[model samples]
Target: MKCWWEHLMHLPDDLSEMGVVLSRVNNSYTAASGEPVNTVQTVSSISNREVNSTDSEHSSVIPIQSKVCEPEEVLIPALPEVACMERGYVTPQQVYNLLNAEEGQPALYDPYYILVLDCRSADRYKDSHVVTARASVTVIHPALGCLISCIELQKYCIILLYAEYGCSPVGSVKARADAPDLQRCFFQLSDLGMDPVILLGGFSAFHALYPFLCTPRMVLVEPERHMLTIYPSEILEGALYQGSATQASDYRIIKNLHITHVVNATANCPNAFPNTLCYLRLRLTDDGQQDLVEALPLASRFINAALKADPAGRVLVHCSMGRSRSSALTLAFLMQHRQWSLLHALRWLKERRACTAPNLNFLRQLITYEEQLFGSRLTSLDDIRR
Candidate 1:
């Protein structure tokens, strides 16, 4: 949690004391000879004769609660209120910095959550935007739709909403006004484990405003007559970083495979390319992934092209580490193309790519997601192939 400064969004207002309680009791206490039992029991006691007035006329009793044991002490840091934003947003620079921060601060040392919502027209969302986006799509009203935002929150650490504000006509399905649905669409996202900072602002804010505010601990506020739309520029800034493993040894492998670009699966990576070679950041949140579930349709279009480019293009798909994310994506490709079943796809990836591993819990949920997709589409996995 130490490097949390890198991925947490700033609180719009300081509400630290609200909905929080902290208390401590020391080990020592003193009591008079004859004392009545009180509701609050005395934990410890110590006596000193210095203050005694050499007379029995008056006696004083100072009682204290239980003392904290030493050597083996309990340190319980408090958690924030249910509604307060705990983790921050992501950015491009943090990805690069994370790969090369000071020795004491390794990029992979800490784990952060990401939440992504698809506010785009329902159909367009079925395609793709940020690669790591989850698939928790529901309506603004809970009873009106099958999806729920709240449930998605239980699985991810951060959330991003991808909207198509002006892409469609005013009455069209994909207007920016669909923004508020992000909060309502999903099941209980406000539950215990959901992080607030990573909830991305309107799509435009992420695609446009973020790059400019890359410094950690800084905030950008859009002022209005009655309210303000504030963005946590720092978390996005610090979390951004360059693409995956840059060791010289890996360069040959990458070039041999003809990788043309790098797709960073974290919101923390820059959206644009750092150099002539194309690079993109897909600030994926677990919610978004829950929606899409599989990445093959997108990855095949992107990665296969790299493989077939004139000079040939190989691609590096990476998340915080080149593990779960890239691996899950690889599984998506197999599910879409190869005849392998979901279980087989995962097993093959793990066997061939040692670094390939999705969080076990995530994998379980993904299985359900895939089953739902298949259940709705093909009668079975076999039917999809034909």
Candidate 2:
């Protein structure tokens, strides 16, 4: 039976090749073919020349059976190996962070600009749906190519599609129970030479996790993203997050970051989730005259303990403003673990968070510590770019 998708969009329903969703992550827009998009004429013209050559010498006669019995060998062309989900599917937690700019992902600290396509029916969408998801009813689809062009799907860094029950892409390209909109959107992106991520477990799973984030309103003020933004700067990819007291106080930020350990470099800041998260609260202040040498061994021991407990665990370090104390502690940690010079560490910190400016005294202490560890003082605050 011809799939309904093949009828409407003239696309193959066999989504076996769809596993390339992870393999073909184009940071920018590019055709999947890796060539420029061409007109339908590029679809190989029907081969017209008939094969005339034949084994004429061997024809009209069968080879006599050899004394030794032998079996015929068969040859078959190899097919492409489907890529498994390495980082293809996005979880509800990750999606929330991607939109809010609070987790470890390609988006980093920036609020990921995304395009969300809701695959449910208009009525179902009207009831309530994921925040910032574009209802299928709101979209018009007279022409597929023109549709993507009108919406400028290429502009988004992340494109997400969700269904009602959240079926696997290999089994069902359609997003909802019986809707082609999701599959249509998938092909629309594929046609433009892009791969869109599927929301793991779909709306049902997402809403179950975060019911308050959904609403009946079809209008998106920001037009496809979360509202409130309070997240930490990713210092070391998925392993470490650096933030201020404000983010540390925000329970949402801590939970989303999956922070297993927290290094609190403040005398006044309370351990917000003491029962939940392990904290190494130093009796240090942001006065720039505090003793980091005394705190360094303690904090490093705490961090190493957590990693030993679970290597996949994540850690968060926060100070009053993530400027002086926290940044210094983070730098110290990097200097110890990453074997980076104070100069290199400062540059790396600033590259991720411009607010990372340890005070003059703190810089002196860091220089002294670096000199002790690596046997030389190689950096000054002046050497680092503003």
Candidate 3:
């Protein structure tokens, strides 16, 4: 008798297409009569030739053999139910709502709830954590096992995990250390059938975005107290004051800087300055998906009009973060007025404001806008020569 390996080597490549089912029983493998086999097993083939008496047709059948081994005790790990397998990223605001929802709330009753797990060191968590987050040591299995048991009792639970600012944030581009403890905990809980999501930007980003909601912990060190006021940075003398939403709200900052016009670039975020200043609201989202191109022409016209309207005319362009959307608009206005390429405009802005990185998509749109205005791409021979 030929070995199983030898038989497998001679089997047809199109055996699957032949509508034959291969199965393994005990120590031997056999091919089913008509249907295809779907059993998991190693396959071997044997050729048997037979001639039909009535039709005088030659038919070939291949028999398969499987290797057998001694039976051994096998244990399978239990997986969580399908309902508890939800995992993804959740925004800071979503996490906040989950923690703040009142008892007997409409959607947040019994089956639907949220649990925030702070996976940082005990000391760091003691320093600060989200108001409702539970600081737990996640490096060990017992700690995670206890959390999993509690999660199993809940009908529908959303488990949010967070650490320091180094973990992936909503709008951050920086990289950080590999968080093995957090990863291990997430996997273990997920395997046991629990819905989990990483809080994007972690506690640091969350704290920065929603400082009012954070707990009052001991000040580790007397870090420089940077006031939250938005002081407008002068881009063009008497022409522009680029800053954040806080600055836009600061009438004193606006008045002291002699800002005659205001361009609000945030969507749904109201303009803080009064009607005394000329207002142009773009209503753009600060994320990468915002259509900065759609508002470019209008924003440029407003900024240019402000500058040309008076020698002392100054316009303040601002967004919620004063980073992505506001910076893109400011760049657009500079490119339009100064006839500078996008690269040159960005360099100039960065020199004035170190934190002016427009999101990737917005930067791409600025390149397209540059091409539209200058009749060439953002980078040209003139730029390279300079």
Candidate 4:
């Protein structure tokens, strides 16, 4: 008999023809270790994922997979990892998301979990810099070298660097003498395994968008001292929020975002604020075993209902980490509601979120969903490249 993946992923089916002792019993797949393997479609989706390969051409993730991975390891790149692999850049909005605090998550306090390094010239940095951001070169306080060595830099969850202007890519200026210190600071952090991202628009872009968040003071106000509650990611303009357990129980955040309806998209996470908010809990796991095709339309109907309820009515779709299950559901919603292809839907969502990575099996299921919806997976890896 053929391997389960051969049927599910539509692989060449020649792998089963190889000398392998693989058999499916009662719809259960077992690997060589005899462990009840859930799903191993990584090999089936490598052409679509972002990788740290030698070839820079396929370095970035475009949210479509058409290759495979070895059973021993999977290196699916989700930005900022994807961004790290090639662009070495991230949007300032993604930076704000990391700094935005949650009830149960790490604190961004005295020993800040998220470090913002201002990689500007000493003179420029001293005049004014982003609040809580340290200068790459020491002007007043510890320099970049001192901070990296003195502090447990690796402990920080998110690390960011920015220059005077970040509107353009660094390639145009990297060859210039005494250019911005963005490259040095970026590499040092990368060497430590703490993936750092250069702010896409830099200080100029950030300050313009959020003048209130930017400041000359290297200190935080009383309000800023405490971690800020996370606002949901805007999946669409119509008050739709894609989020996690962080904002699930925060009534203030929910109300602030005008999120009256919630789609609890996890098997473990409870329906927070059920009494106050409209709820549709899809008890799903983060793994690939659970099929999401049928539930996608169910979620679509529920989301539409909320929008129809009132012009101001909003919906929140959340799982535990707000990465896998929730991301998949959000992609499906776009495909069904906006009539977007899978690649188009994924791209739209990923632009707003760096954490929008659906697991491999969920990806296969989505492909099946697209084939059923639009007749075939006509969007190829080449298509995604274009």
lDDT on C-alpha atoms for all candidate structures: 0.36, 0.59, 0.57, 0.60
Q: Which candidate, 1 or 3, has the higher lDDT?
A: 3
Cα TM-score of candidate 1: 0.30
User: Could you give the candidate ranking by lDDT, starting with the highest?
Assistant: 4, 2, 3, 1
RMSD of each: 25.9, 27.8, 31.7, 17.7
- Say which prediction, candidate 2 or candidate 3, comes out ahead on lDDT: 2
lDDT of 1 by residue, 1-386 (tens): 01000001111122222211111112121222222212121111111111111111132222221321111222222222223332343333332222123222231222223344555555555543433333445423345554534564455434444454423322235532454455444223444344332233434444353332122221112121112121111111222112233321244433433335655565454433343345433445433233222232344344444445565544566665555555565555454444345665555444334345566545654455344434422223333233
C-alpha TM-scores of all predictions: 0.30, 0.48, 0.40, 0.48
What candidate 1 gets wrong by more than 4 Å, as runs, is 1-257, 271-273, 285-296, 308-312, 372-386
Error of 1 at 248 (Å): 11
* Top candidate by lDDT: 4
Error of 1 at 13 (Å): 30
The stretch of ten residues in a row with the least summed lDDT in candidate 3 is 49-58
- Candidate 3 lDDT (Cα, whole model)? 0.57
Q: Judged by lDDT against the true structure, how good is candidate 2?
A: 0.59
lDDT of 3 at 338: 72
Tens digits of per-residue lDDT for model 4, 1-386: 11111212212333333222334555454444455543322221222322111112212111223332211222122221234423667666566545553434424554556678888877777777766787766411335354445246665666778887755554456412334467666665666566777787778877664454566666544355555444667766545778778768787777666677887887766766755776766778777577664466556656765676535568889988787888888877776566677787788777676567788788777776666566556345445445
